[model samples]
Target: MAYVIAKKKNTDEKPFDYLPKFHTLRDGTEVILDYYDNQDEEETYRILKDIVDDGQSYPQETMETIQEFKDYYLSHDAFVVRQAQTAEVLGAFYIKPNFPGRCSHLSNAGFIVKPSARRKGIARFMAQNYLYMARDLGYKASMFNLVFVNNEGSLKLWRDLGFVEIGRIPNAGNLKGVGFTDAVQFYYDFATLPQKQ
Candidate 1:
C-alpha cells in the first residue's frame, strides 16, 4: 500500500508518516490497517455492503453494490483493517470534510466493523489511527455527525477517547426494529486533547 504524506499547511512536518502498518489485538490476532487500495476494493465493498444490509447502526437504507461503493470510497480518505493471516477485511472507515470552504478544517468520519469482528478492539484501533491521520492532514478536529443515542458502546468509546457531545437531534434516527432514537453529534478538538502519558 502506498502511504500518502500530508504536509501540514505552511509547515514541513509530516506527522502521519509514523502510522503503524499492523496491530495485534488483545487475543494476539494480527491485523493490517492501511489506506484503501484498488487491489482490495471488491473485498472492502463486500464487507461494507454486509454492514449496511444489517441495518442496525448505519443510517443508509439501501446497501450499495460493489461499483457504487467503489465510487463513494474513492472520493474519500477510506481506510480498512484486515486480518493478517487470512486477509479478510474486518473493519473500514472514511474521513471527509464536514463541509466546503471555511469549514474544511473540521472532518466527519464513519465506521463499520464486520459482525464477527465486533467488540474485539478493531473500532477503537481504527478511531485512534484515524485521529492521528486527521491531525496530520490539517484537520483541526474530527466529528461524528450522527451517532444513534442508543448505541451505548460507540458512545462510550468515543467519550473515552475525549469526544464531547456538541448537539443532539431528537428522534432523528430510525433503528432497525427499534423505532426512533435521538442522534448525537460528537466532536473532538485535537488542540485541547490531553497529552498521552
Candidate 2:
C-alpha cells in the first residue's frame, strides 16, 4: 500500500497508507496516525497493558492474542494506528469477524488509546476509520464488549458514534485500585449512520 505523509516535521519521512493529515500545534508538536507495523507490535504489548491492565485487565495473553490476531489478519483484514515521532502507541483497534462461516459478516472490535492521548480525538478517529474499513469489507455491524461503565470517555464516544448500550454485565470488572465496576456491552450498526465525507 502507498503510505501517505499525513503529517510532516523537520525530519525526513515517508507516506502512510491509512492515516489522515498530521496536524501541527502552535508549539510545533506534530501528531500523525501511522499504521502499526510488525516492528511496532512489541511496543503495542506495553501500550495495551498500560491502558487495559486495570486489576481486571486480562493476563499476558496479549502477546499470544496479538500474534493470533496477526495470523488471522494474514487471511483477513486488520489495522492499527500509532502516534508518529514518539512511537508511543496512541491507540490500536481493528475489525474482525464475530465468528466463522455464516456469522462472518458480523464484526467485533476493541480500542485503546494511551492515557496521555485521551481527549485528543484519537479514539474518535480510530472509531470512524474502522467503521469505514468495516463497511468496505462488507461488515453488517460492530460489537464492543466489556466496556467499563465508569469509562465515560469511551462510553460517550461510542454512544456519539452510534453504538447503543444493549446490555450491562453487573460487577464484571475490578477497577484495579478501586472496587468492581459493571461492564457495559455496546453495538454499532454501520447501516444506521451516514458515511463520513
Candidate 3:
C-alpha cells in the first residue's frame, strides 16, 4: 500500500507526490492525496464538474470553471486523492479563505468523494490532510459552511476531529422528497491547537 500527495505541477509523470495510504475494510483498497494544479484551471474544473455531476451534490458549483479566481483571484488551494497503482481517483477538496480583509485568517473547505470510494476513510484522510495543509499555509481557523444536517458520516467525522457546530440555517437544503433540511455550520480554531507538522 503506497501513496503520496504532491503539489500540482506541469509534469508528464505522477501529478501528485507520495503522501500516505489507507486500506478499505473489506476489499482492502488503497488511496492517496494529490493536489490539483491551480495553473490547470480548465482541466481541473472539468474534473470537478464531472464529480459534482455524477454525485448530484449540493450548492450547484458546476458553473464554477475557475476555482482559482474565486477569492479575488487569490484563492487558497485544492486537491484530489487517488490510488497509486490503479490510478483511480477517489475524491477532491478545496481550501479557500473564509473571507476577505481581516477575516482571511480563517479558511473553509469542501470535499466530495466518488460513490464507489465511500465508507473507505478516503474523506477522513482528505479532511485531515486539508487541515494540516491549512495550518502549514498559516491559516488560523477552518470552517464548513454548508454541511447538510443529514450528512451523518461527515458530521460525525468532523465532530470527532474537534470541529464544533456554530449555527444552522433553517431549511437550507432540499433533499428530494425529504423536503427542506437545515445546513449546519461547523468551525475549528486551528491556531490554538496546532496540528503536527
TM-score of each: 0.85, 0.71, 0.72
Best by TM-score: 1
lDDT of 3 by residue, 47-163 (tens): 556654543336563445564334322244667776767756667777767666677778877787767677877878788777777776677889788887877888899898999
Better of 2 and 3 by lDDT: 3
How should the candidates be ordered by lDDT, best one leading?
1, 3, 2
Q: What would the TM-score be for candidate 1 when compared with the true structure?
A: 0.85
> What is the lDDT, from 0 to 100, of the residue 99 in candidate 1?
69
lDDT of each: 0.78, 0.63, 0.66
Instruction: Give model 2's clash tally.
Output: 7
Candidate 2 least-lDDT 10 residues = 3-12
Candidate 1 all-Cα RMSD: 6.1
* Clash count per candidate: 0, 7, 5
Give per-residue lDDT, candidate 1, residue 59: 83
Q: How high is the lDDT of residue 93 in model 3?
A: 77
Number of the top candidate by lDDT?
Answer: 1
lDDT, candidate 3, residue 191?
72
lDDT of 1 at 33: 88
Model 1 clash number: 0
lDDT (Cα, 0-100) at 88 in candidate 1:
83
